[model samples]
Target: MPNSNPAHTSKYEESGVSQTGAETALGHLLKHVLPTRQFNTQFPVKADIGYFANVIDLGNGQGVALCTDGVGTKMRVAELLNQYDTIGIDCVAMNVNDLICIGARPISMVDYIACSHIEAHVFDQLGQGLAEGARQAGISISGGEISQIGEIITGIDLIGAALGHIHLDRINTGQHIQPGNLILGLAASGVHSNGLTLARRVLLGETPEMQQERVHQYESALDRTLGAELLEPTRIYVQPVLEMFEAGIDLKALVHITGGGLLNLLRVQTQNIRFVIDPVPDVPPVFSLIQQRGDITDAEMYEVFNMGVGFCIVVEHANDAEAVQKICKQHSISCHGIGYVETTDAGHNEVVVPSKNLIGSGSRFSAA
Candidate 1:
């Protein structure tokens, strides 16, 4: 028989931490940790696909790039709300947003949808959302696949892959991220499609009617239910970022803050560098309500939610920072100089939280 007391479990004996605490720490590690890649390995296939985009050297200054990602467990909230339309847009935005992070111009996209059963209405709404997303990203949906796997899929799963083009020398892979660089933040379009699993588990515990009532209290103009707010399509950054690159700005690195929240920025830099963010904007009301209702820790809230800023660019000191702001304004997108890069000790990459109680507790990136 299994031990009823969790303290007797092997996990507790080995780690000396409580079972509940160990479980939480393990979950956090799995979500936040990134594995290191070795450079001395011989390979039959040679391609680096770690950054926002992967570029292949085909000689002659021409190259093909690709980026792929999914909307993640945000689909679960959409399922609970019976809203599947806008998720397709989230799928596209997640990939294209990353593509632009490496200065790639998104040219085409392909979607993969797996479902438990075939429902024409579901596909219709999903298709409309996907088409609209592709249009917004300035990319064509050449083709995609829909798998009806009843036994494997409990709800619909939407994922996408994007193909793009970039010049050989134009990729922003953080190779030029020097000390004293400026970090520019691009505002998110509400939630922007991440951390929904935790959000739903913690925030949306009420029934559909209860959720409607709660959401209406926050936003008087919101006629749709709470699920609708959760399903807001992710903002596509392809056009604006690409425009910045074409304008001859010396961009050093770009970070797309997705599944891992602000921590995603650490993926682009390795040396002892810190981001000093000042005047962190007020989080969305929905997020505020979630934090208040759940009484969630401030660290957990920033770790799991975008909390306003979504995408960021590390620009060289010599770059035209004003051009970035002007272009973003011309496109009607909000842009701000949120922070600056600072040198640190070896093997330390940190994000300085502006708030003392919340994420401002000095969170360090775990070993990748």
Candidate 2:
């Protein structure tokens, strides 16, 4: 969290999600599940535990990264609007963005759609979004599954797995993210695929006043129903971040700002350093709209939403910061020089944003 926006008394109480319980379950799962995946004698497991993507050796000094993620409660927004096209893009973005965090170039993806029953137009619309997302990421839609489990579930849940390859020498596991490294922030499209449980709880009331509020369009950054803004697809960083690599900008760390907002920065670093982020990017109108409706504090907003910076990069050399800015401009990505890595004065692996009164030393999210 960037600032201590007085923890919402109901942050965990009324919100329908339990990040802490999920992490505890994951910890238990890792203990039993990880011990069984033995290293490949030929393509040995190079990186699996404690990182963004799991890397198993692919022989001849090459490795493969595989990551899978699903469109979470954002799908509820799609359902609320009776729109089904763009949620597939959220599925791809959630998966491929995590794949790139380990410096792998995404090559292909496979989608999974589970619904009570598939409507013909809904299927076609979902496929349209998937195809467009694949084009944006420069990856193939290799294969997928669509199942109608009548009693097993409700509406369609879109999920996907992305695969990428990298030379072992090119892997960036944040092992070298040392003190004094520059942190570069990338702009988000809008609340990219997380925290919808709280959003829906606060925004989806059935009262006449709530209905009026949902349809009320804003004058600032957004011009649609609050529900429409919630349905915006997650942004995919594969192409531009790949361009950064092709441009020879050696990034030491990459953080995908999903779920836990600024605290996602901890995922790309060792436990010995602290991140001091100054002056977060301006919150997009959609997010501000949610804050106003929910009566959410700045700290809580940063805790749940991306707060505009969708992705982050760390570079050891200060001079590389300008090169990064120039290249990102060529791609038209809004890049901000937000913060830097430095030795921890209090604890290990913490992110402190004084302006926001947030200290992200520990994240409530777990990508494991």
Expressed as tens digits, the lDDT of each residue in 1-368 for candidate 1 is: 22223233232123232334644787677554423224323321123444666765556776667778888767866666566778888989998998887767889999999889888888898898899899888999999998989899787888899988877777667777877888888888878877675565445653555544443333433345566667788888878888888788888888887755676777773467866666576677767766665665555556667888888888876346778888888878898887788886645667766653322212222211
Off by over 4 Å in 1: 1-49, 206-224, 357-368
Error of 1 at 108 (Å): 0.6
- Cα deviation of 241 in candidate 2 (Å)? 1.0
As a whole number from 0 to 100, the lDDT of residue 133 in candidate 1 is 90
Q: Model 2 compared with the native: what TM-score?
A: 0.91
Give per-residue lDDT, candidate 1, residue 267.
71
**Clash pairs (backbone) in predicted model 2:** 2-358, 3-356, 3-357, 3-358, 4-357, 350-361
lDDT by residue (tens digit), candidate 2, 1-368: 22233443645336767767778889999999776676436656766576668787877888889888899878877776678788888888998899889989999999988899878998888988898888889899999998889798888788898899898888887888888888999888888898877776666664435644563444355766677777889999888888888888878898898888888888764767888887666777777766776777666677677888888898988678888877778778889789888887665688778776667656542211
